[model samples]
Target chain A: MEQLEYEFDGAGSLRQSGPAVLVGVVSSGNLEVLVESAELGGRGRVVVNTSVRGFGEIWQAVLTDFAGRHNLANLLISINDAGATPAVVSLRLDQAAEEFYRGEP
Target chain B: MTTTSCGTAGQSYYEANALKRITSLLDPGSFHEIIRPEEKISSPHLRILGQPCSFNDGIIVGAGRLAGKKVLIAGQEGGFMGGAVGEVHGAKLTGLLQRATEEGPDGVLLLLESGGVRLHEANAGLIAVSEIIRSVLAARVAGVPVIGLIGGVYGCFGGMGIVARCCNALIISEEGRMGLSGPEVIETTMGVEEFDASDRALVWRTVGGKHRYLIGEVQRLVDDDVAAFRAAAIELLNDPRPLSLEELQKEHGMLSDRLKSCSSAYDAIDIWHTMGIAEPETLPLLDTAAFHKAVQHVYRGAA
Candidate 1:
């Protein structure tokens, strides 16, 4: 298993804060994303724990792209991956972000 | 990506993930997950084996309301490691049942979807299953009706099968199956000639919900829709059956009589024939409503 962490400067703070929103499941070729409100000081932090090793570079690129697309300040994103593709990872991240933004508990 | 719609009427229980099942089965926005995914209470053993771990160990257990009544609910995610029971996953369920015993709820709903004990954590998983069984029985003894629902893609098998039987009652869909040894496991261990795993129809006939319901192993049978499950659960909660020695004796007698009468039956159809159901062969093709109507007389006689 590989554990990767990355930090990104957010575009802006979240519109609203609520309980964490979790999306997806850590099944084969899938992953789970947990988005939580955190005191990240106007930055976003992502921690990924993946079963498939040597994907740190791909995860870095994908998470960087995700952060660029969404306003993730004061958020801590945690991922538990089981060999999911980049497309799946991005999709789950977007879903988690949308749920978080909706403030659904 | 699968849609994150709240458990709606038409949602298929077999396709929903563990969390979705709980959210849908319970009243809308009435679920309060005890250990949320953000807490990261995952399995400690999987990481050592280099296996992927889920945030909540693939089992979601917490307090919820069903039809505006307080209840404890648990759901196993079959997509993760076949929804196998590990130490933490089993512990969560055990703890929930224990809580039910202490603070008697309207009922305890267990949405079982496991294939068995986790091979990676075999010993711990086995112990956990036993503990869950004890907890389930304890809750029932304390007047908390523990109801099980088996309508997932994996179905319930192995140790989890025993746990399902231990519940006060079971609500199963036609798509749900319950058995000790899964078809694939039997095929691998005893050879395909003994139990052909590839023969889906044969597999369904043996351990499927319809067969179990006809044989009196399960109390209620419903369609695969979550709404149907919700309705059945609400009706069941209205009449909670507490555990007692008389009930145990009655159950034992039923099992003993079944064994004496149907032991010679080679297939489920033979058992149905023995039960005096006409046109037993036509059962598999019948829809849930038709199947219920067809078997209603037989059930009346059995009762």
Candidate 2:
């Protein structure tokens, strides 16, 4: 088991402030992402707790790529991963973000 | 492309996913998930074991309308760890049943597809299942009907099997199986001579929908298709029947009588004969409707 946390500065901010939004399932080769409105000072923070160990670099790379692609500012993204590929992790993060902002004013 | 609606042709409840089951069983677009995936209320114990945790803890509970009546729907995601019940998963079910009692839903539909208590969190899962049973009993006592829909890949086994049995009425498809221990477990513990796990037909004949229906364990038997399942749900929800104390007492008497009559009967065919079925060997080959028709003459109890 490995626990890693990272922070990234993003250009965009969350439009809505509400309880956390969760998406995806944590089965084999799958992961769950939780997106919550936060007081991150225009930065996005990510915390990953995974069963597959010794993948710190992979986690950082995937999350970094997601943060770079999306302007997830003032938000906290927490993930519970179970050996999901980079594609699945990115997709789940993107989905959680989309669901988080689906009905914002 | 033609847009096929739920319960339309080509959709089978036995093959549909948990989410699909919820959608098809209720009125179109009527299901509202409680503690949905985005809530991320996963199992804390699975995290300690370094295992993946599902956002809804592998069970989906929500409010829905069935036949114009308000109802609560619960479906298990069997793809997630065989739909095993852990601490969070069990509590979600318990809470849902409790909600049904307090909210006074016309009925509660439980789409059970679990292999029972998760070995990873055995004690917590067991205790939670017990709590769920308590809630089921409470809902019945409150005059809220609780129905079990059992038809999924894993089927309902272990503690979940007992929970299904506790329902006011159980609706099962030919593919649904209900029993305490799985055939593999029984074979390993009691030897292949006692129970052969490799014989799929024999196992189904012992615990599958047809046999359960014949034995009066199941209240309704429908085809594997989603339309059939939805129809059964609609009928039950529209006319909610909470189990009565007199009915419970009658069922208890029947079970005790069966226990005495079949104390040494290992084969289901023998039990079938005792139940007054003339030709038990031909039962497994019949479809749901035909099987129901055939058993009507032999079935004597208040199913």
Candidate 3:
């Protein structure tokens, strides 16, 4: 199979202020996340290690949109995707971000 | 089905390649590989695609001794399709837990490393993982300890990450990662300029093991070495309250608190600084021991 791995370093309060961190796995139509708080100074990051590569542009767009939409200035979001689609990924990222920040069960 | 490669997948073999800290966690030779690769547990769905099958369904299940107590162990073989869980693979895993419940194994140790369900056997794989989780919950109800170990490249992700979180206990090494969605998809839906999925430091800061431990999501954070993991598993097995209700509540509360704490905006470093931890810049870079000793945890004691 094809696998790709990389780490993303985001900027500003978007990186550190997030008392929450979201970790997840990417599969088509679905995703899982581990959202917890961090100590990094709000410069949160999103590391992507996936089996489906050659789509760096798409990934950047999705993450940037989520950060701006939710104002995720403090958390780092990490993920690994096999072949999950855009909708599934966004839902999970938002859910994870919400879980970490909102404290919803 | 390439039986030749199966034999090399023995516990010792896995032990050898396994993260260095995880070694010696279970009893010396108690590992009993179920659905052994040699058994040729291939994904039934693959036959339709004219693809060769694999033994153990890419998942190795069986019993092993963690210290002196008997512990059921299941590990994913990532070499096969990124170690996704397929129908047969999922069944074997569930079956192992089912049998463990029936026979009353001393404890259950899941050497979990998966990318969730196998697309080829989508529905079956999904059901298998779901059932497997139910079975593990059953084991927990029956007083059998369940330890979910995440210390590999694929790690506990997708639906499986939920399973891992639902388990009685969780252990994560640096090499392992758990999340719901990958960045590319998020970027596509949310926009590349918004998420910037290519940033490495950004990712690790959010979902990496250290933060999970800090927020008390992960019970233990050890070195990536297999031996350390093995030791932790062994220690957990010997304890009477290997997986206690009190601990689960604490974890659940952490989740709840996080959900409640969110506003329109949030970030990792701000969380840390607010928690009163100093010099936040290199926090994620700190090793397990260093972080544990250095950072001041926001949540003290258990729930």
What TM-score goes with each of the models?
Answer: 0.96, 0.83, 0.66
What lDDT does the true structure give each of the candidates? 0.90, 0.84, 0.63
lDDT per residue for candidate 2 within A48-69, as digits (tens), equals 8788888889888988888777
Model 1 per-residue lDDT tens digits across residues B1-303: 244554285889988888888988888899999888888898999989888888889899899899899999999999889899999999999999999988998999999999999989989999999999999999988999988999999999999999999988899999999999999999999998899999999999899999989888898999998889999989888887778888888888888989998999988899999988899999998999999999898883211
As a TM-score, model 2 comes out at 0.83
Put the candidates in lDDT order, highest first. Answer: 1, 2, 3
Can you write out model 3's per-residue Cα lDDT over A1-105, one digit (the tens) per residue?
Answer: 222332334455533333333233223333434444455555455665444557777877887787666654445454545566877778878877765665433
Deviation from native of the Cα of residue B70 in model 1, angstroms: 0.8
Give the per-residue lDDT of model 3 (tens digit) for B1-303.
142354222323222322111224555545555553323346668767544344345566777676677777777765556678888877877887888778787788777776788878878888888898898888877788788887766556777777787677777876566666545546778897766668877666666666666666666777776666766776666663544667677668877876665442256676677667887777877877877777745545222
Question: In each prediction, how many residue pairs overlap at the backbone (N, C-alpha, C within less than 3 A)?
Answer: 0, 1, 111
**Tens-digit lDDT track for model 2 on B105-192?**
8899999999999999989999998999999999999999999999898889999999998998889988999999988889999999
As for candidate 1, its clashing pairs are none
Residue B223 displacement (Å), model 1: 0.3
- Candidate 3 or 2, higher DockQ: 2
Residue B63 of model 1 has an lDDT of 94
Stronger candidate by TM-score (2 vs 3): 2
